[model samples]
Target: MNEDITRQLREAAEAHRPDRAQMLARVERGMAGPAVRHRARPFARSGTRVALAGLAAAGVLATGGLAVAAIVAAPSPSPSATVTTPATPSPAVSSPRPTSPRPTPVAPAPATTLGSSRPTPPTTSPSPSAGESQNGPLWSAGSLDSRSTIYWTQSNLALKTTQPLTSLTIEIRIVQTGAVKNTGTWQTLPSDDFTVTVQEADGALVYRWVLKPGRTVPAAGFEFAAQFNNGTAVRSAAGDGYRVDAQGSGGSASVRGGFVPTR
Candidate 1:
């Protein structure tokens, strides 16, 4: 999978659809207060400057060796509709920018590294005094791109540990390598509704968007297109993002910074 890391994972999957449509267009143009504290840090710094321009175009597509044709492909999720979620234990924010702006456009350098496994960097809860009543929906980005295969799943739960809540699910899948078309399975459901950390407007960062028990819309967005080889963990540019949800489920979500590059 090297065609410049599949074109920098297709420009980090189209730069997360315009950095999530400019954070839903700045929450419908209200300025969204500092864009919600740098929402996903400019789409994780434009997904590491387009993944370092896909490692400098993977050295000119690996010296013009290129291999990995079969463009356009992302659809595979029907294995009896699965989608599970109920692990818990993970929270610490930071790392997820490039939802838009600029600084996220490059493609003339190489020095990559990012082999998954860096999340886990968010902690600092405090707020729940006035009459007490807060839970869920602080950060929950769903995914399930389609075409032939491509699935994703994300949850930060916002360093949870309050106690007294319920409902949570986050699942994703996408399998399809060969066999023209006659052997498939694993297309689960239950996509959103973590509860949105109960409105989340204060300091922000308390999310929820679960749905895996039976699903009614499971597949959400971002199907395939991701790469990060070489050493990995590029100086913790952006880390923290892995929380299942459960255990009294008080709810929370806050990952302030973002950025991850190495290869």
Candidate 2:
């Protein structure tokens, strides 16, 4: 047929023949297995390693005895790392000082009574008695009598009472300035025990006194007076005034005033 197909491809190319010396010994053992695993990791030929931390200073690389090159000086932080020192001072204590007591020396009183009158000086008492009354415990005082004559003028009041008065009155007034009438009125209390009067009213000269009915009033200091005339050389009893009202046995009192002006 084409010479038996060219003799069956030359007998299958002489029955397979490709050994080239065993494929060049298996490609030289696969390139000597990565060059013996890269020379067994001999620092892998160090020339680029820098993983630093603190205090280290290596050097070595003039270049190439196997081409290594380390200039590591990278780590530095500890110039005295954190130095500290200085501390000292403590001492000061002083407390405790308090003592008081000493006063005893009196030997002269032993002559006790050679004249013992010095001790009699301890007798105090009797204090309260000021005037101007309003409700009870009475005491009074009014004035204007220097024998007052810049034309007449009398006025006086006095009163005192501390317990026996079954009701009383007194009045007095005056104020009218020029030739003011009413020239008399008086009382140390019993003129028949009160009920006196003088009159003229409102622009003034009043007088009054009153107490008669079984009449009582006796405790002490009495006086009452009035007398008038007033032709002024200096007579401004500034609206005169006097009022009294008593009722006692220690109770209702009322004193009032206004006539002062006697030099």
The TM-score leader among the candidates is: 2
Per-model lDDT: 0.31, 0.59
lDDT of 1 by residue, 1-263 (tens): 67688777555544432234554464456433563465568889798678657655654554343222224244444579566887896896779875875686677432211223222211222233211222343323321111111221122122222332344432212111221111111112222432222222332222334544433321121111111121222212122222343322344332222211111
Give lDDT tens digits, candidate 2, residues 59-137.
1111211122111222445587565665665666667676666667765532112212121111111122322344566
Cα TM-score per model: 0.16, 0.24
On the 0 to 100 scale, the lDDT of residue 215 in model 2 is: 76
How many residue pairs in model 2 have overlapping backbones?
Answer: 0
TM-score of 2: 0.24
